[model samples]
Target: MDTNDLPFKKRNFANRFFDATVWDDFIYRNDDIVVASYAKAGTTLVQQIVAQLIFNSRDDVDVASISPWIDSVYPDKRSKLNLLEAQTHRRFFKTHLPVDALTFSDRAKYIYIGRDGRDIALSLFDHQNAARQDAPLSADKTPPSASGLKVLAPTQTSACDYFDTWLERDGHPFWPFWENLRSWWQVRMLPNVLFVHYTDLVADTGKQIERIAAFLELPLSEGRLPTILANCSLVSMRANARLYVPHGAGLWKDDGRSFFNKGQNSRWIDVLPPEMSIKFEKKAVMELGIDCARWMMLAGPVANASVG
Candidate 1:
């Protein structure tokens, strides 16, 4: 039977059961590396890049299968544990759960990816908008709208609320992005943990990929490195997303496009209003120790703020 065709119940147990099972039980072989990132903070991009670094060749290799998003609300705890226990190869699992919820094991290398929160906020907005209208139809977390454009004002919810609300309160399955980012960021100094910035990845995919490869002790062939970089490029990945997104496993309405949207930094340049930008900047500095002036320089000047 096709693994993709498995009964929905058996296929996705975690979401179905919700009775948190022992996730570690699925480890067939212990891996020295784990890549954790906030939603759309280049999680899939990093996964594909890491998979290529370790395997050297993408041929006949299903990148999705190798870097499975285990914590996603599909595989029940027992099933998840079973899968983890059954795997013998070095693995690279993906997760967005806060660190507190993660079951830590010594020796595993953990890499966390963080982006400027403003970009993250915009990405979340776009992603949420897409999910509301997309196929397989996940719940629409968007606030009701009269103009047909979902509007989320400050009075509504937080930057995290865009997806966290759907995943937790509405029982959508992915891990919460903000909590997960904070959880990992807090302990990034740990010997086994590495923190990567999304902007860094955008600025230099090749360099960042090498950094990740070295962290995992994975050797990349001379020719293989470039190939991997090209394949995981935003354009290529989006063009060939079927190889990565889980839902694209079969020939269903899956587009070979990547889940990654607007790979550029400062996409918030087009999305955030001046007042909201100030509010977000102040919040980020207060909450993340990231100064607004410094971050704005990184994200690019706010048009209104600069003039006034």
Candidate 2:
């Protein structure tokens, strides 16, 4: 519970897209909320959920501007730090870096979201493909140069092939999946950190939200659950994509529906080769051990379904 026991700054993480060093300069507040995830693992969905909770069910919470990716190596990145320092509202934001790369604070609450590597490969393929087609940075879109990493063009024509490269390269052209997943897994025992699975969020959003709300010590207003559930639903988010897509990166499409693609789990069942899946299984277990890996990909007891 003390700062000394929190995850330490063990290393720096940077790619063309993320810069963990950006966090070194960030000053922490007691009530800050940090949403951490390895890319495309429902980071934004939780952001949407948190926004609804913090704003008391009002639907227009501009999460994009308000919940900037604190560690993004985006343009004017330092200015974001300045802006965040100036914010007076109970501030929250997102980060794609692993726990080891971040400047953790005992006073701040942390939420980490995880998804199966197989599903992430498919989702990430769609996400990157859409980015290549888009040309502007609205309040919602991230520019090609944002992450500090070089632009990675889609090398594969299909999601299955993409999965092969993703598994073989370990999140190639983006970032390392195992390291990021493992780093967070190492800290799962921390009292200040909360892990959420993408499947759990999609399977029973109401229960998940209640868990997240409770973790952040937010009291659920009577009858607000329905509104929170409705707003955070994939259908609702896709229908009102503009509102949910965070600033610097929402969707490049005019409809923004591409960002929320399917929102269902296990889209990789028939798509990826079974052999490749076996490889991912070994990697997940090797990287995160069986217990953490199971809780992350599936959900339930054995750390299976606890929002804690």
Candidate 3:
């Protein structure tokens, strides 16, 4: 496919953490891999899986440092590009931008991991609470954040309150949830795009990892599969949680080791108000349509999944 015919950046996206235009300067390689997600949507999990596949189960792969978040405004543009250019290995990076916000390329493979919005909300609540008060803590001296938009640690006192704000404001402190998910969903059929839901990953991580491997054209060897699976597990990742956080710069509270929370589904089950649950479902359908909204919280026909 002609690179000219591929999807390029449609719009610039700036938020507290990202300057989407940062990707514009990147030179895409056909073998490059980009992991796309809307934060806390099993992104690190996918990265860990890809790292395992790429290294064929290297035990000490420091994924966060190696696979930099290209869209982030931190570390400056020159440094980010320089790191990528210097890498001799097949490079894979992470992004929180929607497909349209990205300088998309057919040359690169994109895998998007989505979770139930409710689950993401619950997960993010825990995540943001642990962040430094100044927010997005950086141990090193760094340039100002993207767009100079200052984001403080979340002030919401309760999980329910946080959910209300997250839903009402359309991912307020972060990016738009529906649009990010919808953006990837629209281009999901693209040859380079692969969509893997959180439920699917939770239900059968090994299978999902295999599917990801197939998509990236890097099939795992039989012996590497177990090691890859073990490394990508929540237990394994949680134990090494400090290594997975962005920059591993003590961005998280208490050394960022607790970054990986319970990797289960329906965390917002009985915790959310009945009306709030209804509100989320209605908005999800209205924003993402029935198919996607239904797909978002599929733990088994509303039996296992409360949000459904």
Go through the candidates in order and give the clash count of each. Answer: 20, 18, 0
Q: Give the C-alpha miss distance for residue 21 in model 2, angstroms.
A: 1.9
Best by TM-score: 3
Q: Which ten residues in a row have the lowest lDDT in candidate 3?
A: 142-151
Give one digit per residue, the lDDT tens place, for model 1 in 208-280. 9888878777886577777887787777776676677653422223353425567778766665556666665
Number of clashes found in candidate 3 = 0
Evaluated with lDDT, which candidate comes out highest?
Answer: 3
* Whole-model lDDT values for every prediction: 0.57, 0.76, 0.79
**What are the RMSDs of all candidates, in order?**
10.0, 4.3, 2.8
How big is the positional error of residue 17 in model 3, measured in Å on the Cα after superposition?
A: 1.6
Off by over 4 Å in 2: 132-156, 247-251, 299-308
Relative to the unseen true structure, what is the C-alpha lDDT of residue 113 in candidate 1, on a scale of 0 to 100?
77
lDDT of 2 by residue, 1-308 (tens): 76666778888775667777777788899889999999888998899889988899988887877788887766556778887988998889998887788888887898999988788888888876765443332422445445433334445577787878888887876788888888888887898889898888888889999999999999997599999988887788777877766443333555666667776587777677666666677677777888777776673222212221
Which residue runs does candidate 3 get wrong by more than 4 Å?
1-5, 132-151, 154-156, 300-308
Q: What shift in Å separates residue 75 of candidate 3 from its native position after superposition?
A: 1.8
State which candidate, 2 or 3, has the greater lDDT: 3
